[model samples]
Target: MSSELPAFSWPTDPSLQPAIAPVPTERITPEWAWGGSTGLGMKVCIVDSGVDGDHRAIGGMLRGGAVVEETDDGVEVTEGTHSDLFGHGTACAGIIHSIAPDAEIYSARVLGKNLKGYGSTFVAGLQWALDNGMNVINVSMSTSKQDFAGILREVADQAYFSNRIIVAAANNTAVYSYPWLFSSVISVACHAEPDPFTFYYNPDPPVEFTAPGVDVDMAWAGGKRATGTGNSFAAPHIAGIIALILAKHPTLTPFQIKSVMYYTAKNVRTELAAAEEEKRDE
Candidate 1:
């Protein structure tokens, strides 16, 4: 005679049901995620050198911006319009504009002409973005200094909790960096793939996604266009996608938006295809 086993109650049981229903995989397709979305009514901040609002590639999407400069007292964040000190910020803004043309772009100029700035200025720029109601902040720069890591992590966590999406670039070289290394922000790196829309999700930690960044042709300062390659460019591609996603679904939090990205990622698509094939065979 066999002994009767106790029933195992699943979480799906009515008495133990979760407050929120799980999203169906089929509903997380690209068409459902960002189709027909032009990023209208979304505010995206580019925290970099600066943004040239006059750039042809930007198409007058630049709304307003701020400049963060280190001073004797402390970091001074000046609010208003600013110009791109280097072409880097324009390149990032162009990538995002190309993908999400209608999204309002704001520049938080932290770096000067040398493409370098004090980590304090960088933190100030990011803080300004969060305090000013930016929906998505594209941070193509990171500080390798451990001195700023603690403060940077705090800002990153604040963004995560506030439903703000921060898309940060992984360091181009094998070096330690803050913000990007933090789990709170969406970290991106370059994939050799040239298609701007084609991105892959990595199961690995730290770097969660890869986008087209190799030899990417983007807008430059002085109203010119140029080709550049770096993880910096990759961050904007993901930021652009986030803008589009938010435009379509404005209420999605940072966590839910990341889930949407994971579900729509190329690797996930491959898995979906294999599952469909297996089902057909069965």
Candidate 2:
């Protein structure tokens, strides 16, 4: 059960540029018309470079134990380490935590020291997330090439069969990136401010949704701010949205959750129609 793939595009839209915004309380605040997401009691696994626990945006949101390892340099690094060296993972974790404040976060530091790593490390993290009972697994990484070894694909299938929801980042490039490229995971694209610029290079169901990513501002190391301009940032929003959805319907299977999200997405057809209209207008 998959949708046909769509063409891709990347445009310079001023309104789409990321700007300074609040700490993503819309997904959590009761005042929101969408209602607050009940991340309480649900545990989310954030598989990324790591998190800086002390960041104001993430303060008490950080939960779960650390998975640490020593780098070739002999430096010790911890999972949910609660500190960011490059700030990329922190920004991503902030988005997920902001939307699912009640949801406990389990950090899996697959990427270490600025996110330079091999595919095996990420695969290991994915397996770890499953074994530890992580209801939601957020993978904000991409592999340029698409290769499916028997065991890796089986692992993805096992997670799906076991009812674990995995969210992945669509590759920044026009080409598909794995595990987002893999049909088992939810692939997310970037949608930025004002004009709401969207980047959907892949047309398959894998590239299901889009969220704020462009010049979006988020917490960085040393109390600084960083702006990202890619789908990488957008993926967390989808992960966060999933957290909200799962909180409401705990019994939903991965397939059912994915279907409901697509069916209930705010103005999805309208947005796609509008995109086509704009293309015609151009």
Candidate 3:
């Protein structure tokens, strides 16, 4: 049996900027709602520059994965000795391991030594994750090109309906990006704060959660480490937590996962505080 693709938004009308918000209806939360779980056995795929499976920080944790190598024929995905070309993938994997130590980490290497890749490679990596049965995918990279937007959106929606979660990072700049902006995925950007466990759900659209991605220390290539900042780093933190959520619940749909994230965010109490103040006045 095959699954049907979810809805798509081409947005060629040019009537609005960044597309006029997704109307899923607004539902607010009063407090944190996630529980404790070790994230054991959850299949978490880091779809980035690939994971340095040999990195000490990841030590004996990788379940399995593949690397998208370029060939004259086109793109070839090879499954062996894949290590982080740059420090990005390892850093993301380290963050996830720190948060969810027991979650089985996998790598779908798409980026290269330059830490950048074309849209086709990005899409290919994601499709590999979906096909390989990854429960949660961490995509710290996105293609800003308008050409690949529709296809990426379709894939993201497919992941959503298929019970797979794709946590994506918004672009570092204000430029437009796909997969992250698509409503099907959990789009994230960096906030000024430093708490890895702290996340804020935007009551607005395009971007959803805001987590730690500033001046953060993380694992790097060649068993080294570094401190950096970007929405890219923030994404893994969410993915790690999602692994924990799945560990305990094990059957949460994408919609339900979003609800858990929104309510569990640190700033979730603002509206509740307002509601309480209203009651106090009466």
Top lDDT: which candidate number? 1
After superposition, the stretches of candidate 2 with alpha carbons farther than 4 Å from their true spots are 1-34, 68-82, 145-149, 194-206, 269-282
Q: Rate the local accuracy (lDDT) of all candidates.
A: 0.94, 0.69, 0.85
lDDT of 3 by residue, 102-178 (tens): 89999999999999787887888889899999999999998878889988998999999999999999999987788
Q: What is the TM-score of each candidate against the true structure?
A: 0.92, 0.73, 0.85
Clashing pairs in 1: none
Q: How badly does each model clash, as a count of residue pairs?
A: 0, 11, 0
Name the regions of candidate 3 deviating beyond 4 angstroms: 1-33, 277-282
* Ranking of models by lDDT: 1, 3, 2
Q: Which structure among the candidates has the greatest TM-score?
A: 1
Across 98-158, the per-residue lDDT of candidate 1 in tens digits comes to 9999999999999999999999999999999999999999999999899999999999999
List the RMSD of every prediction in angstroms.
Answer: 5.8, 12.7, 8.3
| Candidates 1 and 3 compared by TM-score, better number | 1
